[model samples]
Target: MSSIARRAAAAAATGLTGAVALAVTLTGVPSALGATTGTASLGALRASTEVAVAAHGVNKEGYEGDEAPAGVDVHQEVSTAQLVEAADSVQDPAATGTSGTRTGIGCSGDGTSGNRVQAVYVGVAGQNDRYDAVVGALRAYTAGVDGVYLASAMEHGGRRQIRWVHDSSCQVVVDHVVLNPSDVASFGAERSALVAKGYDRGDRKYLLYTDAAVLCGVANVFTDTSPLQSNANNGGYAQYARVDAPCWAPQDHSVEAHELTHTLGAVLSFAPHATANGHCTDESDVMCYVDGSGVVMTQSCPTTHEKLLDCGGDDYFNTNPAPGSALATNWNAANSSFLFDPPAPTATLSYDGSAAVLAPSVPSGQGWRVDWTAPGCTPATATTTSPGGARLAVSCPSGGTVTATLTQQDGRTAQASTAASASGTPAPASSAAPTPTPGATANPGPSVAPTAPATTPVATLALGLTTVTPKTVAGTRVVLTGTATTGTAPAAGTRVALQRKQGTGWTTLGWARTSAQGTVSLTVAPVATTAYRLAAGTTTSAALTVTVTPKVQVSASGLTVKGAVRPAAKGTRVALVQHGRAVATTRTDAAGRFVLTAPRSGSGYAVTVAAQPIAQLALSAR
Candidate 1:
């Protein structure tokens, strides 16, 4: 065989498990294939190889004129045993079932909230058919990334799933972005076209699945390379990732995942085993770089782990890193908000006449509890006994106010309330006293009537319950809003106090009066996890918990990294992190201040404060 063909064979056997095979034939020139016996079948492969070579200088010979150095082809295919072991490491699906094929693309996670990764079908303007042939495969591919074993009878690990954009039917949502192929001939052009179509947003990571075969795939790797600023700002690059049609097939799942990981900020250039181009040098890992043209690759993890990320769990994507590990201190792709576990249990209250129904949105038979109070009645509690997102009913006889407080399994609490007038009718007006005629009061004989003593009218008040806008913060401010009502009417001008639970007692933090619309708002910056509620006179709303993550303010001059933690307390641990590695550690003095000197790596730095325990009162009771 020719030297080029020999290299091609080795690349197919060792480089990205299935990518090189799509780019080259085992016994052909690296750049192009001559007319062969199976000319018809090889036509598409030939065209793809030419595009990859012309666009990326990627082929069996090497990358950009660089030949593969000796001993570089060390990676091998993963074995069945290793695959089984990796599968065994995953958490079992809490429920037993397989999801049906998702037909259409929709928003991520119920389409309403959270950071999302939207899939876009970018095609040549004239192409018809929304690439429907590959949609199922793409979804299955995503499931595999979340640790599902494709060969198994039932899927598992609803524990972690790609937060893909999906429609109301639960089918994957893939938006169409058709452009003239000429306009997006390069990766930069592709991104520009997407931006021109208004795909740029901080909350989204756009995954572009293109029908064009310009190159295998490419993505922008946004990193924070500043010495002083927090690397958390790198979230601005959540906008783009692309997979070319030629780079993937129904049987190949890793390429799209490979490209998507780049958008999630993986394999930083400073990673312990990463190449100069931000790919790991370790083999048997999805994010590893084994193209044979750059840094020498090592077969550190067995080939079975080729489909997994961070084979050793130290480089980029560890779900739970050991204390003081690189992933524990720096950026970890697993921590990306684009991936999510099953949602937390939730309950919402709605009214059905005099009955207030507490409806829980949770998995079937998940345990839940609720405590409620009705007007002119003592508090009552109930728990779910059957299955599904069950509903509990509370009766309110007087129709003044009813509040239901729900408790999640993890002890978090949420409250809902409703107000309605009894009988849907207005109260009768009090009768006025009879006036005496001008001079007719002198008849004080036997038939005179006596007057009854006057009585004052009483009013009932209700406080509308709402949680903080952001239930969690990193030393930032959160806005709390509430509404007050007096017997089914807006309680305008009602004085309300914002109180935080403090050691079994409530402390007033701020006070405000209800607006003309009965709305009240308070902005607070809490340094620790705390329970808060709104109170008007003797009536208090249900508690809301706001969790605070310690924020580390970092500034570096020369080799010194100095920072302070908010809610400053003595002995707060601080670490200087860079390139997915923590290089220095120190403890704050009495003022929550700390300083450490680190070697200049020019790739930027991040300050991470060790998690400090904070006292919190449980907002939920059994």
Candidate 2:
């Protein structure tokens, strides 16, 4: 009957959805809840109000927030549909399902059967311009993925590369959505508006936000975003990707990639209870666990949410096969959203009597390292060369475990376990002389590596850049050729790119994959002195410096010296030489022509190009 009571009734009737201060309750209530209950049950009413918001799941374990009975660890529940991808049906028991689409993204006709093109539509919490940045960052982040795939190739032989099947550009689309809210939608009521607005259905949405103390991601699909995902069971619904605003703008790309990985597909065993410690085994990987210490962990979570664990520096594309790991299975689908994906690269680790060999079965740009720990000996690490072949000897008669791991240039690594044997029998005869480790004492006993397989191996890449002629005139087309090798044999079909050095940076002018003989050539015109090199994976050719010289045209206006610099660039100095002695000097103008002020007869005339500014600095300073 009272005015305040009447107003509350009207607000409640409208299905309250706003902020906590605005929620008519407190903090964050259901986007649909008003704070007014005007009674003692305001706590109970507010509790129910917060449940009405349409975001995603919120953490409640050890969570002392306004919700969850204050100050106790209650395990939070999340739905399977809300994770980056609902994998309940697509689980890769072998962790080898080309990520989200190992069998091929279901397509039709000229299409691969059972495959479909997948797209990710990015949405913000609200429509405000402030949220536009989230969409922009998402696009920028996804663009770098293609390059990462190529550059980080682990050399899985036989079409392991995630070569796209479509000539059309989109494996995944990164753009803003008109139907989704642009503000923080960590509650159910808000995201419900997105569904009503008619967004791309099927949990393929990525929402950007500013909230820091809530759910960063969920493991399944859900119907609502109430705290702890209580209504997640029947939500068989549109789950999405969400991260704090700072996460999108962070200094590292790992966070974005990490978040995207969740949406693509995460390992089911990666939860706290699964002994995975909320991450994959590799500490250096982008998907490593972030612990309570803020230290990125190299180990699994013994208990759930005890510490904050997420991806770390070692978290890069895990193309290395992970027998049963979900990360490997989901990598392709997560990266491209194409139902079709390529297999992770493959390699073999074996030992002759003395040396351990890690040989690539495919062409990979990535390097590898194997740690050899004999039955009772200290572990020693040996790394592969650029094109990637690593051979290190373990002490004989002490067979041990050989763990092969993908190695990073930054010295980080992933976790893997495999077996290695070095002994209990006589060493084999040496096929070739042992390559000595610097400062290592030669073993008294002769050691032989395993016999070479029928096929020669790809080696550490060695590249060379050369022109038919080292010197040439400006504008003259010159034939440039490059040679590449794995140091042991000619590297065939490896990607070789041409680059020109400018200042401290190198720009790619063009690229040609290598021929069977490991050669790449192209024709180029040099207008000025330029240095060029060839890059193959992590190896670069020696710099080929080409010196371009220009011929000048000289004439006379009765001793008034005149000349044109062939390149037509100014600063050439023309001298009037009388019997090989300079009688007058002048510099060329913008048109590259120079003229003397008065007449002076000369036996001969010559024009000299000005020294480069950098080389003339000392002379000018004097």
Candidate 3:
């Protein structure tokens, strides 16, 4: 089917409110807290990475007389070591400090990064598997085909402190709060009622990760609809979504990523501004609207073009991009905007006679191997999956020095040496270079070639000119239209500003939030030939100069005037003066140009351009 036809049919099927009612996945059964917050400094760096809040205009309730507000019920957040910095994983936790402004969000729980947080996860009837669905989808979106964690960067709006870890190593500590019918009553049906009833049970909430948590339910989420639909310009302190087709039930992580990013900020009614809605125009994004048909819509299928339930299964561009927008790409396509740099592995090494052990801190998905160089000593060459931590056994002289080489997932390597004594004399100083701070990239291969991808530049948002009403202007005002995508069509209600270059800086003339296909048309009139551009979020389109032609005609006669100009004009008087004495005066025609013929030339003459004086127009009839 044509992309347009498919989109139209999908819209007909679910009638999702493009912005608020985008279908998501998940299904949870009330489960217990499996792992406690452990002080496992196991590669846990103590650096304080800054987290910014994007939810600007949440619907805070004032129901002291009744139930709590929309996002009042606070959940416990899992405090796994928050990712601040990592030079290929092993990092100095104290090197960085927390940054970014924190707005008061209902779920900004405990004020401390929980050592662990939970939400009311609801999904398909009879199935108690919301947690797994979320986790799997989370894995699918955050950890892509290579298994590197890429979603957390969304929290800081593409600033920094992003890193990757093994699927086993980067495992998040999460718990769940089972959602029931009474719980979702607020979400599934009418909108504000969800808030009213939700305030009543404000007591139910679940786990918090480093990022803002979302309340997963199975109902439609928009309450006010129309004028409210115009709210892409605002943000919510917390997000409450209802997954339809409850088929993926609560398992659809793509939708989860979509709603979750709204709290962080993206594809708003206006780009770069966290106003109103939180969805992109791109259907591939987790935030785009979709026809709730099948269950699995996120994973990349082997078939080319074929997708599961309209989901943009290409996990590459999972999140939408805008000005300050963020996304995950292969390390090869990474630029300064991506959170994680091209990875270089870091690890610790030790050895015993006949055995050498090496542990590496990889940013997930990297395969690692350890090697040994000592008389009679050989270490295991097979790679230990990142989570497993590479370990090798070798036969070495007891009194001789044994060196262990650790290979990283990206082909970079680090090595250390330890001298062993039969009597155990302090094990001869061990030497494995300290890991660099996160964001500090390096390559140290252990006798092997690098496996890291080639360094290719990438962008946060892809914006370009698609259409304009008057291809060539015959007048001043022209209608210009265009498209912007993080990689897909933006959600409805998001803003796209029409900007004009004024002298040195660009100023906003007006905005056109976008239609379903991620396009916006705005009629703008520039007084003269002026330059124009489009701004959405932090992304701006290339400057599109709209050529404006002004009609300014000058003629000379006795007390007469004639002229023409476009768009029409703001009034200005045209004085016909001979020397310093006025002979005749008339207002410029409504079109901006004017004519004034003096009855007599008594002295010097001076006629000039609107703003700049024209010396050539001075008549020499002294």
Candidate 4:
């Protein structure tokens, strides 16, 4: 059967006939399910098929080949280290010190970079805050394909991040382009909107991440009748790709990377294992279509290879291809300019009035060091070190030009100086946003030059008692508000950081620039009872503890009651209390799930985890 007919039969068998939209595979073929391609009017495309969320248990979306691919002996099984690395890739840790603003409002890349994958989150207008999940998925996908982390556009502080169209107030701007319920499968509509928004640069490979429940993922493949050199097929043919929210996981054949692989010119028609379109017939390969091609897919590599590119290394991406080999002669993805191993380790030193904090960007297996000199400070000169340490803080009140030299274990050295200044009175809150403080400077990376002169005195900044509100359950965000002052005057434009107590030192969670009135309001999501403080330079607010209790999810089935607690820890006690008494008690299992026999006569029951109040649920006696 043809790919379209097969898709229709499957959709009908699964009762997903009307709900199925156009399936655009790597070949850019618009499935018979009703999608028009290449200069066809979009109105006809939208009218041809209904866009409904697929409720089938099986995910029928993604590449078109056939059957389960067979696993092979040569493919490496996933190691614990690889799993950990994959997990780390998706983690979005809070930023330290003052948060820097970016030029773009809602997206993550500047069109200037050479052949970079622009991370984009097509969130609903006026209703998103840096879709952290999308960012995490992109990071994970990039990390898995290449050892190096994906590079992003630099913000004000030299931090690489996603960019989208936003106004001066930092609100996302979507130009009447709807991709959610309406244009979910209208790839052309999305492409047009992005192009109108100045995202049509030929050098960029735009990774459009959307919450839309469209097809699993889709991208246009650039290919020819024969194998060509990697340089000849490098770019510009296909630039934008979509990875719907459903397929963002790194495990689903590394969906984002797989779609991107298509745009990167993989599995040429001339390749030995190439399928009709741009997919290979090899099993355990990310670019191999698992379903519709005439050739049945069989894994020639281990199952772990599903998260990788070419299976045998002879197809499209062998780093060191043998001479006269297909990969050596044709377009190779491993040689793409967009991919690279992680760069050398480097650190930055910045003195924010009250203290000098050294931040390092160290690659794997590398250590960092910081040596400083500030004559008037306590212990004028000292050295601090840590094994791949995240940050090091030093107390230096006499600012002036505080200089610090950082050396990586390999002996690569970089020096930076911050001209710290004394605290000044904050201007009254104005209708306008305060000028953003110049980002900290370092010799090794991009930095905004410090504004203060070298001879400026040390700042004596202090924070007032902070106030927190609305004690919340786990997974909810909380707000902390306070003000910074220089003596009795407001210290406007000073950078204030929110820090959490960890061990003996305070770890910076997130930071923001003080308002014109010197007030700062920071938001954080604490999973457990956490001690937090506000800091400006070395001065800090009184420690305030925010209490967070584990949230419980309870459901009743027949005579049995089952529930789970977030942050599931094995051995945590849970009790279903009735009339201020424990009626049923159980300990959470490793999955944080628990079960208890419902009392035969219970009408109202309160569930508690570790003696903390949870939601009240009514268990009906059947």
Candidate 5:
């Protein structure tokens, strides 16, 4: 029968299932074939011709068709054992059946039950070699699912049987070149052969014809049983599964996952229905059809392949409740509770000048309150001052136990305590005892008198120097002031030296003596960067380093600017001056080159490069 006629007939018997109803349809095929084929005597010849025509239209229909002649004697039955053996040949080596003691292959014990999954392979009986790769990929990908069984039939078993394979633990079944070689027109020929067999039309099951013409894989899940009459009717391949044109990168696992998802979507009727020119591009879903053809083809569904599968969303995608719809929504909802992981408890103690305090804060999402208590002190309730900040204050007697308690928003509390003591005071300096002095004798005539040697006052002094500015220009004058004190006031001429710290010692720059006020100032020439220290008597102050940045002067010379017109070119030369002396010079080459040097100490200077004259052209400065 013609592809169209077979599809129309299938549509007419939509939703019919079971052996009782199938038997009635099988008995009517011969009569119908007689009318459609025209010559009853040449039934075999007519059947062969019909198969050829249908196989040619297989691509047009988007699936491989059965190529058997209508009345030609062909094997229709195969033993269950033979089917199992055939399937095992194509089975994935990794797939294993459930055995309680079989370490990783058995069902997990975490409430998923001991569902056994088996793998069986069905070999290809057709001309397409791609089926081998496709089947292999399916086996390797679905090895983790429960119970996979492979089966094969001498004749096509149709869409209902295909749906059964997907719905059951049977991971996949492969069929080789079922299309007629002579009939290479539309793919509808393949669909026709399946419809001729007692295939179920109620559950829209589709076949993907991944041939040379369509290098990309194809997927179809029909909501309605009249597979041929659906939008898949056009030459575009309707009742049609989605088709991905062949791509060079067969490693594109996302494409395979996407097609498989469509199959799963079909069984669940979860994918959006094809609409508007037999295409659905609206909505940010993987199921949405994309526009364009060839290698650069775009898809209507949101490309979650990278985010969902590549990231950690594969499990969610595999068990998507909505199937063909947006998988992201369901995935996010399932993992909402695990979005943010709470951080562990962390406590930090810091001193604000004189007080030692402990501040504890938890993550914002975790509602925790902090309370503080101390021995011989008042306990304070913890309060949340900010989204993530909790404040707890406690007053304790000197040398007491301080405890901090953390209460979670869920009403669970934990406490941590530490023993602490008040800081001690510094001891006072001791006073020196009075010293006794010798006295002269009384009642003596013309006696020799003795006098004690003149006492010398101890000269004790201290010096300190500070840098008012951290950075300065070369040759900039810097002030160094020093204050000196003595045990009995300085002799008014004690010298204090301002020195710079060298490699391992101090080098005195200059020296000054203390006045009656015991203070002195020293002025020194600033050359290179230096660190200064003040020395007086036996005391030396901390070192203070001051960095002296050089002053630079950059200038442009021999600048010639034509007019701002066509072919207008300008040339300029530049020279660098430092400390009242020319240091470097350079000329412009096509563009402009300038010389840069450090200037003498005085504020700072900058040179500008202009496109036109100084007043009219754009200017750039350095």
Candidate 6:
């Protein structure tokens, strides 16, 4: 039968919603046995005994709330009656298999009962006029296939029954659809609800098939083909199938057959049956390519159909197949061989100041061996049945590449590589000379021939300071100077600035640029006590301090001595001191008058005065 005809038939049988179900297996009661070593009474008693054992062992492990079993192995046989009885103990009678039934409505496949595949067909009730044709095509395609069964067309009851028939650990049911553009959101919501329920109940895997438009909208707003796009964009399972628009609806059944190939592809790609033997470019496999010519249906392709069922290059229906084919063929393919062995030990390699290097140990026993295919780097060798099971260690040689490869025993190899680059660190500051302090000079003599510009190779600019005696004159200013030379002659426009340290940061006070002779003189009014430094570009000169004293006067009344405020103003008050000792404390009566004995000439008498609070003034004399 042609693939299209078979698909159509399967669709018809399963109905519009594709709700067909499978039958559960049951075990029978055991016959009584005689005990020859016992007495005649004991033998009769034993002969009359009838022990009821489960036809099949049901593994409840890993089956949590609403979770289905991992897989059902039904190739082996036991009593159908016992299976039913066992199922009855765990499930309601309505969910149990009836006597002599080969296929139960809404039932799930059990590997033990020899049922491995369950098929369903999706179609719209009134809108899909081609439903019969589609179902007929599908049925003909799957004829005489072992472990495969077709679902009936009734929608609601069948879905519920399928869910109930399988134990929580083993069976999965996927809903398939071809959505119109307008129905995408509704379709997505339905799909999400199904997946959410599955996850809430502890089931990890789900299957879905939708049109390319829907899939593209769901997976990537920007890519061509994707499985995860449908599920993740729709917020559901990790995987899904997308049938290109040119294939299913409005097109021929050939496209439908191609989509069915995708259904088979998903099962082959995921857990319990995954293989590393295929690539997307492989024309011989349906899993490798999508079938169609840009939006238009043309001729049918047999190679396309053949690849879909090749089951990893082995002919369809082969009993003992290669791992690649086994994974690609059916959902129930055994995965025991896919297990990976422990990895080999690691070895340390040479180490540079910036990075450490290492090599991989050799794999001992074999199934598959790991190879560090990364150029100039090595990975630890290890045995594994699957890819990505070994470890690799490598340090990037300043701006280079590293690659890793895995070689299977069957000559099937896969490689992955990455690139590396170098990074730089900042230089540290100098510790030889002290940091230049604000307003200070490093030298103290009349400037000799000023050195060349600080940028010159021979002469570096340095600061010098000179004292300024306080005079009775107002507006007196002190000048600070620095010297510099440029190779043969100093460059002009050499600028310098002064900065004062305040709190945690520096505040700019004044600036001066040097002339062609490389000398700078800064003038400033001396304050009480201040520290400042001179800066030239990235370098600075040392720090210095200056002091200023106010004029003093004293008067006396008997032994008590008082000092008149030197400045004599509304803001100043006077206190008396004699022989360096304060004799009395008094404030001027707005006349700046305080009484005190006049000290002899050059006597180092001291006096104190408090200034008005509003002016922030205080004075001392010695």
| TM-score of each predicted structure versus truth | 0.39, 0.30, 0.33, 0.50, 0.23, 0.21
- Candidate 1 residue lDDT tens string, 1-622: 1112111111111011222211221222322112221223234334543222121234544322122223222122121122222322222221223211111121234654556777787767753323433343344334444332111111111233466665543445667768886655655566656666777665667777776544555654433222111232133333466656434421212555666676666566446886544467667666665444555777777665555567677777666667876667667666666765533434545544423444444321123355555655222433332121123333434555656554433233556665633443322211111221110101001111112211323456778657545456444567788889887789996767677776676654434678999998877655567678987644678888887776556665667766666545667677766655777778986446788777654554566777342221111111
Tell me how candidate 2 scores on lDDT.
0.36
Winning model by TM-score: 4
Candidates by lDDT, descending order: 4, 1, 2, 3, 5, 6
Q: What is the lDDT of candidate 1?
A: 0.48
Candidate 5 residue-wise lDDT, 1-622, digit = tens = 1111111001101112100001011111222222222123123322432211010113233333222212211122221112112322222211123101000111112211111111222122443223322443333233211111110010112000012122121223333434444322222333344445422132223333233332133333222111121111111111223222121112212233334333332212221333311122333222233221321223333332221221222222222233343433222112221011222333433221112234433321123444555556443233332112322233333445555554433233445555443342211211111111111000001111112211333234556666566576544556666666556454365545566765676544334567787767755434346788876423577877877543322233233222111011124433333333334444443212333433332222223223211222222333
Candidate achieving higher TM-score, 1 or 6: 1
Q: How does model 6 score by TM-score?
A: 0.21
Superposed on all Cα atoms, the candidates' RMSDs to the truth, in angstroms, are 27.4, 20.0, 25.4, 11.8, 33.7, 37.7
lDDT of 6 at 365: 14
The whole-model lDDT of each prediction reads 0.48, 0.36, 0.33, 0.48, 0.30, 0.28
The segments of candidate 4 whose C-alpha lies over 4 angstroms from its true place after superposition are 1-259, 267-457, 463-467, 496-511, 525-527, 533-543, 551-573, 579-581, 586-596, 602-605, 615-622
Worst 10 residues of 4 by lDDT: 6-15
- Model 5 gets an lDDT of 0.30
**If the candidates were sorted by their TM-score against the true structure, best first, what order would they fall in?**
4, 1, 3, 2, 5, 6
**Candidate 4 residue-wise lDDT, 1-622, digit = tens:** 1121121111110112322322222222223212212223223323443233321223333322112222211112222122223433332111112211111112222323445566676754532223432232233443333321121111111122222232232223322333344434345556665655666554556667655544455555444323332232244322566655444444334555666666666666557887654577776666765334256866587664455566776677666667987766667766665554323444455554444555444332123456767665544566655421222233334345556665543344556555544442111221111222222211122123333333445446778645556466665677788788887788897756566776676654434678889887876655567788876543678998888777678887765778877655678898888888898899987557899876665566777889876767777656
* Decoy 4 TM-score against native: 0.50
C-alpha lDDT of residue 293 in model 2: 28
Off by over 4 Å in 2: 1-379, 382-402, 407-466, 474-477, 483-491, 494-512, 523-545, 550-603, 610-622
Q: Tens digits of per-residue lDDT for model 2 on 1-622?
A: 1111110000000122322111222223333222212122223443554333221122223221112212211222221111211111222111111111111111112322222222234334432222221222233333233223322332221112222222111222333444334333333343445445553243232333323323332222211212221122111123343443322322222233344343333322323221122234433233443222233334332222111123221222334434554433322222333212332333444544345544432112122233333453333444333222334545533445554453322233433333444332322222112222111111111223333221223346789888778897655667888888876688886666666776686644444667999888867666567788887544688999888775455554454545565444555666654444555577766445676433343233443455321011000111
lDDT of 2 at 423: 36
- Mark the regions of model 5 whose C-alpha exceeds 4 Å error after superposition: 1-135, 141-171, 182-185, 197-284, 292-622
